[model samples]
Target: MRFIRTRTAKATAATLVTVPLALGGLAAQSHAQDASPSPSGTFGPGCSALAQKANTAKDKVVEAAAAYPQLSHLVSATVRAKLSGALDGKPNVTIFAPNDQAFQQASASQLASLLSNQGQLKKVLTYHIVAKQITPDALAKGSFTTVEGGKLTTSGSGTEFKVNGKAKIVCGNIKAANATIYVIDAVLRPPS
Candidate 1:
C-alpha cells in the first residue's frame, strides 16, 4: 500500500509538469499566429527583431546606420554634425530621414545657414525624433510631441503617411536593432 501511494504521488507531479509545458507551447504558438505580417509582406521584420539585436535604442540606431549607407550619411554627418554633443548618450531616438531628393530641393545655402545656427538645427532635427520607437502602424491622424518640445501632426491613410503636416514617409518601417527609421520625402521643421 505504501509503495502504491508513493508511485501515485510521483505520477501526479509528472502530470502537473507536463500540463504546463504543453500549455506554454500552445501559448507561444498563439502569439505567433497573432503577430501581424510585416508591412513588406514578410514575417517578423520590425522592432521585435531590432530589439533582439540591440538592448537599447541608441545602439539600435547606430546598428541600422552602420548597415545602411544612405541612412548612415543622413544621421552621422548631415544631422550628427549639428547634434553631436546634445544627442550623445541619448536613448530611444527615432530619426525620420528625408531622401536625397529632399536634400536636393533644399539649397546648399539653406543647409549652411542651419549648420551655422546650432540651436535652430538641433530643434529641427530633434523634432524629427521621439523618445520611443513608434511603428508605422502605431501612428494615426493626430499630434505627437517630439523630444525637442515641439508637436508634429501626422495625417493620411495606410502607407501614405505624412508627418508634421508636410513631410511624407516615402518608405516606411525600416527597423534597426533599437530604432525605427522612416524615409520621408521632406525634412520636418518646427512651427515658426
Candidate 2:
C-alpha cells in the first residue's frame, strides 16, 4: 500500500510540474502565432498591398541616391537614419522624397550648417512627412499638416501635385501598409 501511495504522489508531482511547462509552451506558441507576418509579408492589417508598394519606394530612394552621389550621401547619413524609427509601426505616413537636383541647388554651406544641428535637420526632414497616406488625387488645392507641426500646401489641376507650394511631385502614389511615399523634385521647408 505504501509503494502504491508513493508512486501516486510521484505521478501527481510530475503532472504538476509538466502541466505548467506545457501551458507555458502553449502560451509562447500563441504569442508567436499572433506576431507572425501575414502571408503577404506585412506585419499587420490594413493596406497590405500598399505596404508592398512602399518597398518599391524604398528601392527607388536607394536608386535615386545612387544615381546622385552627393544626394545619396546626405540621404544615407541624414534622412535614412532619421526615418528609421518613424517608419517602424502601423500608422499611416507620407514621405516626400526630394531628388538629387534639389539637394544640389541648396547652398552647400547652409546644408552643412543644417547637418551640424541634428535637431533642426530632423525637424526639417520630418516636416516633409504627413501622418497619413495621401493619394495624388486627394492633394488638390489644399494643405496637409506634417508630423513636425507645420503645414504643406498642395496645388494642381490633376495628377500634378506640389508640396510647400513649390516642390513638385515627380513620382506619386508609392504605397506602404501604413504609409505612402511621393518622390518630389525639391525639398520642402517650414515657414521661418
Among these predicted structures, which one has the highest lDDT? 1
Collision count of model 1:
2
CA RMSD, predictions in order: 9.5, 14.9
Compared with the true structure, model 1 gives a TM-score of 0.61
Clash pairs (backbone) in predicted model 1: 50-177, 60-178
- Which residue ranges in model 1 land beyond 4 Å of their true spot? 1-59, 76-88
Off by over 4 Å in 2: 1-74, 77-81
lDDT by residue (tens digit), candidate 2, 1-192: 999999999999999999999999999999875662322332212222222212343343333333333246446545534655455453667777665667777899977877778788878877877887766556777688887898888877444567777887665665444556566777777777
TM-score of 2: 0.60
lDDT of 1 by residue, 1-192 (tens): 999999999999999999999999999999876765445322222223222322223344655555544454356544555564444445545667665566667789997787677677777778777777666566557566788888877776654677877787766666654556677768777777
